[model samples]
Target: MSTLFPALALTLFTPLFGGLVLGLVRPMRLAGWLNLAFCALSFGASLLLARDLLAAPGGVYTGHGLHIDAFNLPLIVLTSFVGLTTAIFSRRYMLEMYAHGRVTPLRMQVYHAMFQGFLLTMLVALGTDNLGILWVAVEGATLATVLLVSLYRTPESVEAAWKYFILCGVGIALALFGTVLVYFAAQQAIGDPEQGLTWSVLHAHADGMSAPVMAIAFVFLLVGYGTKVGLAPMHFWLPDAHSEGPTPVSAMLSGLLLNIALYAVVRFKMLADSALGQSATPQLAGHLMMGLGLLSFLVAALSLQRQRDIKRMFSYSSVEHMGLATFAFGIGGPLATFAALLHLLVHSLTKSAVFVTVGHAAHIAGSQRIERIRGLIRTQPAVGWALLLGVAAIAGFPPFGIFASEFLMLNATLQSWPWLAGLLLIGLAIAFAGLFRNLQPMVYGSAPEGQVAVRANLWPVVVHLLLVAWLGLAIPPLLAGWLQQATRLIAGGGF
Candidate 1:
């Protein structure tokens, strides 16, 4: 019982400690191994913390401005799991890059250190109880990821990194402004300026807060966090960043980081719901989300048809899926909210799996251009098959967790907004066609010249795929209960 706090502390601090050790070490190999071991340890700690959270579901753990609740416990676990898997995948992947002279030993050390820093920032964001501190944590993540995005030091990579930094930095600043506004709204209720910004205090007195201030605060928070969530009109930086960065970074960006930003938005959404009443905030937020989501879905579907880069195509697919998840939460009902949570889980797992395979394919084919990388099936069967299956799962194929979640979301949408349901189906079908058309040539066409067989780290890919399959086929009762409890929290039920 007493071990839970230490486990939580370890989960938050291990990565930072690892990053420091890696920075001081001379040899790149040792640094990489240390990064991997530290991530694994952090993941294990997260699992222990999750078990504690589940066993004592109603218990509150507070430290200074930090709060651990059911809402963020699962998220911390998922984020840590992705960080661990990505670190494992990076070991061999980075080594391969080093062998090719694409990365120097010093740069590899930097990559390892930055990766841990990125993980630490995400953990801080999820675990912090102070709204202002959460914004700062997210800002730290943005800065750390900017360094990773430009690791290659190419012109395109630099450009992508710059764009990502500027856009997200502005967005995060807006989020900070929104946080201040939330504190203002809560000050009257909580009666202490500092404690008013704590999530527990804010939520506890939410019903007594000023609705107008809450409404304004939500607008800022949505636009700010929505940019990070890759919501359309604000998602321009996402594709370029994904396409230009290393594929492993792309996987982490799509699979884990984006979800963390969305988690932040959902937390604020929950706060707004409590402050302004559920019907007041959710309705406005949902409509805006639904509109932006549909726009992103349609635009990305059309954009996918014209993609020349394989990574860019998948990047668009991320936007589309994110739009769908945003739509689900925006709809704001029990079933829709539950489905949104499911979609987040499945999308993170499946998208990361896809990127792992894509990274291997790009390595073997020696190019990310979609047309040049043909006959993956002939060149490397494992990677080719993984890519195909991963794409299928992401494109909403049945017996995949995404399909189940999407179906639930659509059902919920249809019951309330039939027109939006129609639009969702149309966008999905269009995106599916566009993605598969590109996938076919890559999977089954003639092998191009100069293709090389590379060693693929199949473990991470297999682990993610298996989780998606199992979750889709038969979710463990305990996991389902956790999801339900999380949904109930978002739905404003204490139990």
Candidate 2:
């Protein structure tokens, strides 16, 4: 067996085992430690898999219904790493929630179990090669997160969870239709059910599939997955979920889930592109992506200025950033795709770090309201500065990875569709203003009387910010080459 087989199995099954074990482990403290341990083991295995893939010729690994290639290798590693850090952060954060009577022992049990399960689903979604399996994993993630979102059992939390389930449930249903359509096209082209549903096989035979069917399928797929991506008009559940869920759940939703959804969209795009390449409107799929992405970007940007809750504000920021990344991918070139990949990495780092900081901030002020959470610098310097820097990184400030990616994306836009470049710039500016307007007072304004510091785990935020800063200053040669390989995989060439 390939070394990749064991590493991938460990990376995936560790979480599965952890989730099952955690479900029955009633001691909240013990469960928390186990959750962290499981995430750490998964991250370690992912690193080993990354090393194995790098050493292997052609940077590809395939076995047991899963595929690892240049495109997903980085994402797999990223997902595991973020999951691990979020686990670390939550160990301290959730315990505090428990102490404060915000979470009961049983709820904590559910939270830890569902957290591991969520990671498992994300890993399965990223690692699988069968499109049908991908859909199931994503649906599993929805169920897991729905439980997480409603852990507080508050009226609003329950409402948010139900809203998330209904919206994403409908969205996933449409995605199922799209998946069936893809399978339909594949059957006509390849004539074998098993091989036809395999993504690699479909990609290999995409040109032989029906263009019209693929075109309609791409529409359903985009909207379906795009809803999860938090793209505009389909983003109603996002802010509520972020606001009502635990902060850690907010981090995963913003930093990770949206990317997985976008990853699904991109995979389908590859097949759609190949199928539509010879059609009369060759760029139909790309055009559709561009329109939705741009619309999401603009809408989220304007929406940000109106958010009163700090978490909701950042959630809209997630929408804006995801939109930008989507738009870059839609541009369809080496530079744009490279930027999109980088944006995904940096945004995940920055947003998760920001949420970690926000969690602490809310704890400090005893509220999530923007007006109530004042003078974080006075209350807790570490949390305050981390929030400031994280917001700066996410807002596309220089010397952060987000800025580098956005700059490249802008350059690509100017080259490909100059007219849309203005819109991108405007959206960026508006989002920046929206974030800082609320953020500045929170960081520097007067603290309320009797407000005191809370114990915070700043290590995750520190590590994530440093990584984002390092990537901005210079992409390490190894990662640069790896991203270039993924760029080639997605765009058919390297920059």
Candidate 3:
């Protein structure tokens, strides 16, 4: 009998299997049902993985060539949970598309299959022990999502897909070059080329590696992965892609995929800290990240004020939140790192919930333009309330997980760099203003004509929002402990 951790294998491959089956199936209805089942199974397995991760006193799970630690385990669970919720939301969302004659049955099957494949890529990215494998997985996700983004085959969608492909392809190439440099650095220390790219192996020898090469590699890796992270100057593709893609695709892009990419950056940053010493790498990376974060925060805040499309507005918000997460990690302390992880969780949940609600609103209102749609409360109260609450949570309103995480981040910054803290506060205030300025007209004004009631799947939105809200008020002691362990590992303690 082959004995292995069921959660790992199941999480990594179930979606691939499901995607294959969905592709082969004849009927669209069966494809949807199969996708739901596969996602549900994956989610259940992820919960089990989270349990196993929590139950392990040392927070380590090592089997075969794989290492499941506190850092990646929570990420895996988050990825799977988002995948499951998106799957559930897609059932009704896509069927609505079919009813509107926007897609054929065969096309729906393709979408379902591709959705699973996308999940598989994200899972593989989060679970891999090798840095090179993680890069490949992220690139694979980029390709899969390009297809999903262009599923509608409209001129705008195709353009968005092309932009996504070009930008990400360039980014992946740079990342590969950086990966090669890292391998070379590791080879000098460990004297084995093959083992050089393994994360655990590299971490073991990081301190012994050449500092200059590692520094150069870190720059390449940051710029490359930063594109995927949606940091400024490299974020041109995000808005178009999110605005034109299927709503579920947009949700996953913002909620799960960006976090996985940032995780890769954090992993490398950990390695860099080990290689170059903590003070050197942390300060260098922190300054650059904070600069980029400030730029993204301000740009997105102002951009939000000009957004005519509702989803595009949120896409800018995604860029801003990604910036905030990057800045938190850049600060590189126990408190900031813990806040980064918490921010990732809350942002993923809240953004996905918001997008699901946005999809429902778009469906009922028959438009994506913010100016054309008004008075969501009068039209579709469920989606209206969900959007309002989601925006509030994402904007760092009181009693929300985002608020708690942001507050923690600010406190950390204030202790170390009070000037940076002030800058962060100003950026946050700007964002709050822009978000509310756009949100008021969309949610509280007069309802426009052509609005029809949609059979919205409010369950996923409700579940995600509730979780985000709960995390704000109270974090489970166990989860907090796991985050603390992960934070310590990133800080310097060997996992």
Candidate 4:
């Protein structure tokens, strides 16, 4: 428990310091290895933080306007783990891209720098206790990713970056306005400007805030943060960004960023629920989340059938999973919230693995177009098998963590709103068909002339998929207990 403070500091600042050093380092090999080293340091710190939290009295740590509880501790660890693995995957992938003259030397430097910067922002966003700081961190991540998305400087990549910038910029501005409203309410209730902006303080006094003000604030907050979550009607930028950006960046966006944004939404929802519990529309926030979640789920699943680019297709899958998690959160019960948390964990792991495989597949085919990628099994058995298995896990196949999480969510929906179960079933079926439709041809169809294997690192894929399998087969007692604690925090009770 005494290790908490230093661990937290290292987890948050390692990347910040790494980015500074990497920006100045000239050798590509050194830069790449340094990136991995920094992420490893951060990941190690997160593990220490996790251990400290598990051993601590209440599974929490708070100091210097930062807080860690069951709710965010798992997420911080997941973010760091994915960051480390993605760094491992990216070294070879980006080095190969550099070999082919896809990225200039300077752009590579920027890429490395921005990668660390992005991770730092994400860690800060998760660790901060102030809503204002959280908003700033999320915005900072958007900026860092915008740079990464445009690293290639292709017209398509640049266009996608601009779209991501404009949409999320507007969305985050709305979130800022909502934050101001929250602070206004907090000031009204707590009457301390500085502490009013603190999330712990606001949460402590949530019930004393005006219901109408909280309700209005929640609407803005959801739409704002929901945009980052890639919910329906605000998801147009997601596919393009994922498709055109570097595959490592795609993995980061799909695996980590969306979850961080959703964490923001859930935090606000807790405040809204507390404030509105005795009001006329106690479940107003929940209803809004449910509606948007369903819309995004159905729309993204249906859109999957229309994607020609492989990465774009999986980006839609990310949207669908995030939407499903949102719907689970909206359902708001011990079962539903626990399922949503598990869904986030598995989806992040599985989807990052899928993107890494897709990166290798694209390298083998020299293109990301689905039609051009063929006979992966013949060219690279490791990549092909990893892709097939990763997608299978992501599509909710049996014995995958995704399947278990989805089943739990379905059971929860059956208990709460049985009428909507059919829609969920249809969405899952459609998404499964959409993915395999594009995937089978790529994995099993005849190879085009000159198709050959690249030096693919499949360790990350294996690690992620095995964890997903372990979770599906059985949740470890320790992880299950952590999730149960988080569930109690969110749902006001534990199973």
> lDDT for each of the candidates?
0.86, 0.93, 0.87, 0.95
1 versus 4: better lDDT goes to: 4
Alpha-carbon deviation at 313 in model 2, angstroms: 0.3
lDDT of 4 at 394: 96
Q: Which stretches of candidate 2 lie over 4 Å from their true place?
A: none
Candidate 1's error at 467, in angstroms?
Answer: 0.7
Which regions in candidate 4 have their CA more than 4 angstroms from the true location?
none
Query: Over the stretch 1-495, how does candidate 3's per-residue lDDT look in tens digits?
Result: 222387768877899999898888878777888899999998888887777666665768765567788898888888899999998999878888988987887778789889999999999888888888899999999998998899888999999999999998998789889999999899889977878888988888888988889888988998899889998889999999988999999999999999998999999988887777744544665667767766877778777778889899999999999998898888788888888899999999999999999998888778898877788988888878988999999999988899999999999899788888878888888888888987887889888776767788899999998898899999988788778889988865422
Task: Note the clash tally of each candidate.
Answer: 0, 0, 0, 0
Residue 345, candidate 1: alpha-carbon lDDT? 91
**lDDT score, candidate 3, position 360:** 88
Models 1 onward score TM values of 0.97, 0.99, 0.97, 0.99
Between prediction 2 and prediction 3, which has the larger TM-score? 2
Candidate 3 C-alpha RMSD relative to the actual structure = 1.9
Candidate 1's residue-wise lDDT over 86-143, tens digit each?
Answer: 8899888888888888777778878888888889999999999988888988999898
lDDT of 4 by residue, 1-495 (tens): 388899999999999999999999888999999999999999999999899878888887778999899999999999999999999999988998999988999999999999999999999999999999999999999999999999899999999999999999999999999998988888889977889988888888999999999999999999999999999999999999988999999999999999999999999999999999999999999999999999999999999999999999999999999999999999999999999999999999999999999999999998899999999999999998999999999999999999999999999999999999999999999999999998898999998888878899999999999999999999999999999999999999998
- The deviation in Å at residue 491 for candidate 3 is 1.6
Q: Model 1 off-target regions past 4 Å?
A: 57-60, 278-282, 493-495
Model 1 TM-score is 0.97
The total of clashing pairs for model 4 equals 0
Best by lDDT: 4
